[model samples]
Target: MWRAIFRKKLFIAIMTAQFMIFAFDTTTRADDVSIGFLYTIPTLMGFLIIERGLQITIVVLSITLILTGCFFPVPIETDLLVFFANRVLSIITVLITGIMVNYRVRMEQTLGDALAKERKASAMQRAFVSMVSHEFRTPLTIIDGEAYRMGKVKQAVSPEDLQTRVKSIRQAVSRMIVLIERILYTSRAFDNKISMHLERVNLWTLLKSIGRQHSEVALSHQIKVNVHDLPVSIRADRNLVTYILDNLIGNAIKYSPEGSVVEVTGQTNGTMAVIAVRDQGIGIPEADLPNLFEPYYRGGNVAGISGSGVGLYLVETFVRMHGGRILVESVEGQGSVFTVQMPVAGAEPAPAVSTGESSFPDKQ
Candidate 1:
């Protein structure tokens, strides 16, 4: 409430109204220039309330000019020298007040901006810690279970059983490694340090590799690849493309039922390479769809699910880094589909991407 009173527009309006009130006070015995001292309020407001220095200077000068004209028409009761001196002193006071107010406002604005940025950084840090703790649990559990089973066998476990436990441990370790890498990448993204090194990449080969890895890591979910229409290659940052594909497929598996088939399709659309991932999962609500890719935002339906809500955020970031866009379509309790479009290799080199609102496809 107090801040609103100090806003430049409101402050200016109040000061102007006050000056008008003074101008109409017909019972005043003061000299005209003394009444014109009311102009000082606007000059002080221009410096203390407005953000643009040049604009405030113009407003103060206009107010001074108007007040001078109003005073010129009034007859002075004192000697001419005294009248001139008084007006000069009032003008000097206005200028000095304006200068001091401007300096104070500038310093306050700088301090406020710094404090706001610090608060935002602190919030990100808290989210990062929570995500790390949540995401590491599954892998750590897997490793712990495998270790426990091996210890229980007490040298009587078969060679095949030991090997199976070892493989599970390795898989768990791989998952932990990937989770850590994502945390690091997300931190860099917050700092806007994401750098892309584009190159010609084979689409078929990349999709196949991602499918194989998903199948190996998530044995319960199956990934189906459909790249019959995709070009052999496209210009992109190979690592970024892999990151995008990995997150989409991983999210599909994480959200879907066991044995559900997640479809990965790639094709060429105009000069762009389009990749779509569709899953038979509990879909997002209409309200949640808009916030799906927001950092640390999880859907209402995912209350019991194990997720940090960073996968889609990372996917969106990586796609934009390739100068691409992502689209999502979902119906609650039915399924969800995510489509990514990137400029194809040999087409015009894509411009650097910007952080903007995501667009969703119209539901059928």
Candidate 2:
């Protein structure tokens, strides 16, 4: 804010000085010379103005002022040819200076933008490395711990205990596989290498399958699916669609408290198929909403939650590939609802969905 105020003050000062020079040039007559050339000073100074349009306007105004000075009161002894020639020369000088200044400013802006992007990429790379290290270490530790426990047991292990240890090892390995797949998916998404094997898929059947799978893993959370209004079938990439749903549902379960409800609702809107995953979870902070889908960006409030932060990014990417969009609404400490809208197969593109007020009710 202070910088903006300073810029405004500087702009006013430059314009004021330019006008004063114009007034002096118009009022004074010096033999056969033109003082209009002094306008170049202000035209060059226009570099300080951040806006290219305003800078160009300054140049044009300077030319106009120089030309106007020619018709202003001057000595009768002043030669017309010399006066007109000098004014034209002054216009050319100011115009050239303005162009150079504008060009320089543009180059500076481009360089600044490039630098900003570089910085962001660097930061993301560091975060990705750190996250990968931590994510891999957790599963590896679990697998190692289970192995060490079985090896150190002095007595014969019971069948049930052996099964539990084996399950733990498998779960750890499965988690590692998931992490690998997510990383691979993100890479493919960035390279635009993800190919969709479009096929007619049973949407309702897929939802039930996903719900049952999540229910097995998150036994404490009640997973509910309502697809009464949803289209039974749609042409889509089954794998990508599954990825989208899996991520949303998994996140809903993972982020919410044990015993909380995770609801998956589906419906149709015009030419669109809408799916929403709502959860009674530790709601996202309002400030984090805008960056929620940015890769490696986790919510500020999810301190102890285990996450790689790529789930929502992949979700959004897959949805876009299917010609859909995702909308999210959350109130801190209440819950969140993520709505996915996709174009129905064999239909014209659906109209854009407005994310008006959130449907998630405020907690009493």
lDDT of 1 by residue, 1-364 (tens): 7787567567666665654443332113224565657656764665565556554555465556546555654454655555555555665675678678877878888999999989977886787788788778888999999877777764587888779888889878977877666677776776766666667899899899889888987898888998988988888766777778877888888888998989998888988888899999998999999988877778989987877667788888878767779999999888899999988853244454323322211111
Candidate 2 per-residue lDDT, tens place, 1-364, comes to: 9998898778767775775575456435434344565555764675556466665565566556656666677678877766666656655666677677778877898999999999999999999899899899989999999989988999999999999989889989988888888888787777766666556889999999999999988999999999889998887777778888988999999889999999999999988899999999998999999999999999999997888889999999878877889999999898999999987783233343222332112111
Lowest summed lDDT across 10 adjacent residues in model 1 is found at 355-364
Among these predictions, the greatest TM-score belongs to: 2
Model 1 stretches with alpha carbons more than 4 Å out: 1-31, 42-50, 60-95, 188-195, 212-231, 258-271, 280-301, 327-337, 345-364
Query: Which ten contiguous residues of candidate 2 have the minimum total lDDT?
Result: 355-364
TM-score (C-alpha) between model 2 and the true structure: 0.82
Error of 2 at 124 (Å): 0.8
lDDT of 2: 0.79
Which is the leading candidate under lDDT? Answer: 2
Error of 2 at 156 (Å): 2.1
- What are the runs in model 2 whose C-alpha is more than 4 Å off? 1-77, 346-364
Q: Give lDDT: candidate 2, residue 89.
A: 64
